[model samples]
Target: MRIMLIGRWGKTHALAKALAASRDVELYSLMDKKNTGIASLSAHYELGNIKDLSVIQKFVEKHRIDMLFVVPEMSLARGITDYFNEKGIPAVGPSEFCTKLEGDKGFVRNLMKENHIDHYPDFHVFSDKKEAVEFIRNYSRPFAVKPSGITEGDGVKVMGIQLINKQEAMDYVEQIFDRSIGGMASVIIEEKIEGEEYTIQLFCDGKTVVPMPVVRDYKLLEEGESGLNTPGMGSVSYPNHLLPSLSKNNFDESVVIMERILDVLKEKYGEKYNGFLSGQFMLTEQGIRVVEINVRPGDSEILNIIPILQTDFMDICRAMANEKLDEIKISFAEKSTVCIYAVPEGFPTPSGKVQIHIDRKRFEKPGIHLFQSCFEAGESLYEPSPRLFAVTGTGDSLEEAREKCLEGLSGIRGKNIFYRKDIGTRDLAERYMKKYDLPGV
Candidate 1:
């Protein structure tokens, strides 16, 4: 099978390397907005930006591509997938109907509430600034305001009760509706849920859904998630901790929430939909409430899930193409893994030029994987850009894996480069305290 992976970033790099390693597979082409990694791979084809349907058509026809693996930010979803299906090219991503799940937050939240899925507190979607301000001023506590479409993580802003006065609240309403994507005004406000957050990733091929390990993602770009939220800064997960069967101990409460959400989507949208379903959930005492739904794999979390997957991910993609989900046997390792981002100072935004020196041999010492980001492929280590690389560690325990990641990061000598020191701290503490019957809150 010839596979074409979209987005030549970190995920594409890892996915391409993994898929190319398989004896039964051939990576035909890879397309990115920019030609960053093209020089590295001989067979790699740079299609520039896949913005228009005509461009996508040309690329597919030229390569005779069979499968498309979308790792892009997803605005290209509707165009890419629709073209593929029309041309009889198999695709693994959300359909036009399902892309709205991520494309429109207001729509999905209403669907969740109507279907009895535990989401954030009750809220209203108001197009008018005055109406939204009136509601926000009368609300009891702080709430989260977001731009409905892709602002990356920068779209979400958590405002306190008194922080947003009449004037500031008025400004927020304008900002929410500032940008629009896919023709809908980009903005929604919701009462914030107070609890721990986790991302539940599932691979679905219309009928069957295969869940990955429980990945606890860290949002903050700096230590303790204090600064702005960039694309994920880091993540960690225990493959052994994820239960195969529905049980109180091993089975996650969030799993039930995700299953219910999928059920509702499938029932209404039809059984032909196929893609990766990711739910950003706030795990509270009340239940698991969804924060957002994504159409593709979560960034840093993908690094963790791939290592534990005993079955080839390509097989799952093939089954999805054939609509034979049950034929794919999915299993994971009984180990833990952590993927940490090595960021530059003033991140979640740009700071300035920074020098990064890395010793690959030191990081690859034992039980560790390095995924380079904002970098170039070469033998001599160099800082092509600010954000040097992402260092991942795997082991039997969280402590073992985290230590290896931290030790690996320390080896990188860089100027004005900084990363969150506590990527997996809260979750590890939460897991340990739960074992002792203590408070993880």
Candidate 2:
């Protein structure tokens, strides 16, 4: 099978690694920008804007590509899948209209309310700054303020964490209206559901849904869960496929909610949802509450889960393309996985790019993998805008995985590079459990 993978990020690098491992697969890549790691792995590499259908169409025709593995949500939002599928090329992703589940927060909130999907948080969408401020001022409880559109996971501000008080929340709404944050001048004020957050990613073929291992993603930039929110800093998955603080019932409930949402997309909206769907859920006192829905795989989360997958990934992609996902039984290895990202010192605030150095030969050993998120600036020099790369480790136990991940990360040397030292550790897990008053493993 000849495949063309889209997008330019750490996830693209990870997917390229998985696809290149199959001898029958000829991997090709079309990146909006240059990514040396992805370029190195592809049989053919093209630099073109992924949102431009003309560029992609020409590439597909030139290569006679059999399958497209689209990664970025922005490309999906641009209707790349719909365009290519009409041309008889199978694209592994959701359509443009279907991407509203992640692209538009207001759409999702209303869908949940209209469909009576359980676990929907209290929320109100607003376009007027005055009305939004008035609503937040009178609300008695803490809430979260979010841009109605995608902000690459940095637009949300929760009360008591990002925003200190109601006044701050109101100020944020005003800022959103003035600045048009998240590419829109609208805001979503949602009742904050406080708990430990975890991600549930499922593969869908417009009918069948296969769930992957549950992953806990750390969004905060600093240790002890302090600092600004990033796309992701690190993530962890256990052998049991459930976090220590999460119950099996809650885990299953999260999957059921995703399935329900997919059903609504098909029945009510006439949109058959395909590709990867991830529900970011919180295990609150009231059971499971969904934080948001993602149309693509989570960045750091995918890094951990893909390494432990026991089944052939190419087969899964083929099944998704053919809408025969139910024909295959998916499975994963009984192993714990850990992924930690290394970023520049002044991340989320934006600083000058720092030079990065890595010894690729050192990672030939077992249980250690490296995926690049940075770009090459010069000979033997790399630069990181936010995250540079990720080091993943797998083992029979989480502790062993954490140790190996740290050991693998040691080979990556860069001035002012930072990574959390406590990811996939017992201390961090216990701290989170205590903070939420949840029972530990």
Candidate 3:
């Protein structure tokens, strides 16, 4: 089978690695930017705008692509999946209309509220800056200010963390409106729910939904979870397919909520949701609260997931495209995984490009996987657009996995390179466990 992968980043590289593992699959990639890691794996590689339908159409016909596996949310939001499906080429992704679950936060919030889906935070969507500011002024508690559309995971600003006070939130809202952040001049202000956040990713083929291992992603730029939010810094998953402090009940509840949302997409909106569906949840004082839903797989999380997967990824992709997901039994290895991302010094804000060096042999050790995320500027040189690359380690326990991951990361050398030192650490997990009264600290 010939499959074309569309995306740009470490997640896309991870997908390419999984697909390349199967001898029955031939990989073709179309990336907006060049990723040497993905390029090396692809039988054919082309650099073009993933959102340009004409460019993609020409490439698809040129390569005689049989199937498309799109990863990035931006391409999905541009109707690339719908476009391919209309042309009778099987595409593994959600349609443009279905992408609003992640693209338009306001739409999903309202959908959950109107459907009476429990655990949704109180929120209001506003297009006018004055109205948003007024709402902030009148609100009694701290809230999160967000752009209505995709922000590459950097558009959100919380009251206590990013914004100082109500006035700062109002100012941020104005900036979002004025700058047209996330390509939309609208904003969503939701009551902040403070707790330990975790992500549940599932595969859907319209009618059937299958859950993957739960991942706890660290989004902060700095360690101790205190810094600006970038795409993702790193993530951790255990051998039992749960985080350190997360119980099986919590994992099951997250899956139920995601399935219900998929049901609503089909029954209420007449949209058949496909591909990967992710529910970002927070275990608040009240209970598990739905933070948001994403149409694509979580970065860094995907890196942690693909390594432990025991099932053939090509079979899963085919199942998704053919709507026969129920026919396949997906499974993962009984192992823990830790993924750490290396980024530029000043991430979430532009900084000078840093040259990176890596010793590929260091990743040759068992259970150590390296996926590049930066742009190649020269031989043995990389320029970080934001993230440089990721090193994932798998073992019987989180501690061993973390040690392996850090050992692999040691091979990566560069000036002005930054990464979180505490990712997948027992200390961090214990902090959450004590705070939430969860067992297994």
> What is the TM-score (0 to 1) of candidate 1?
0.86
| lDDT of candidates 1 onward, in order | 0.66, 0.89, 0.89
Ordered by TM-score, highest first, the candidates read 3, 2, 1
Query: For residues 253-319, what per-residue lDDT tens digits would candidate 3 score against the true structure?
Result: 8898888888888999899998998889998888889988889988888899999999999999999
Indicate the residue-level lDDT of 12 in model 2: 83
Please give the distance, in angstroms, between residue 200's alpha carbon in candidate 3 and its true position after superposition: 0.6
> Which parts of model 2 are misplaced by more than 4 Å?
none
Q: For model 1, how does the per-residue alpha-carbon lDDT over 154-207 read when each residue is reduced to its tens digit?
A: 566666432345456557666565535333564576776665566778888877
Alpha-carbon shift of residue 153 in model 1 (angstroms): 3.2
> Candidate 1: misplaced stretches above 4 Å?
33-42, 160-170, 179-186, 242-253, 351-355, 363-366, 375-388, 425-441
lDDT at residue 156 of model 3 (Cα atoms): 87
Better of 1 and 3 by lDDT: 3
| lDDT (tens digit, per residue) of candidate 2 on 1-441 | 889999889988988988888758999999866789899999999988888888988999999999999999888999999988888989999999999998899999899889889787889999888999999989987789999988877889999888988888888898898888987878999998988899999999999999999999999988988878888899999999998888788888889999999999999889998899989999898878889999998998999988987778898998998889999989999899999999888887766667777888768889999998877778756766468889999999999999989998999887888899989889999998999999977
What TM-score goes with each of the models? 0.86, 0.98, 0.98
Regions of model 3 farther than 4 Å from truth: none
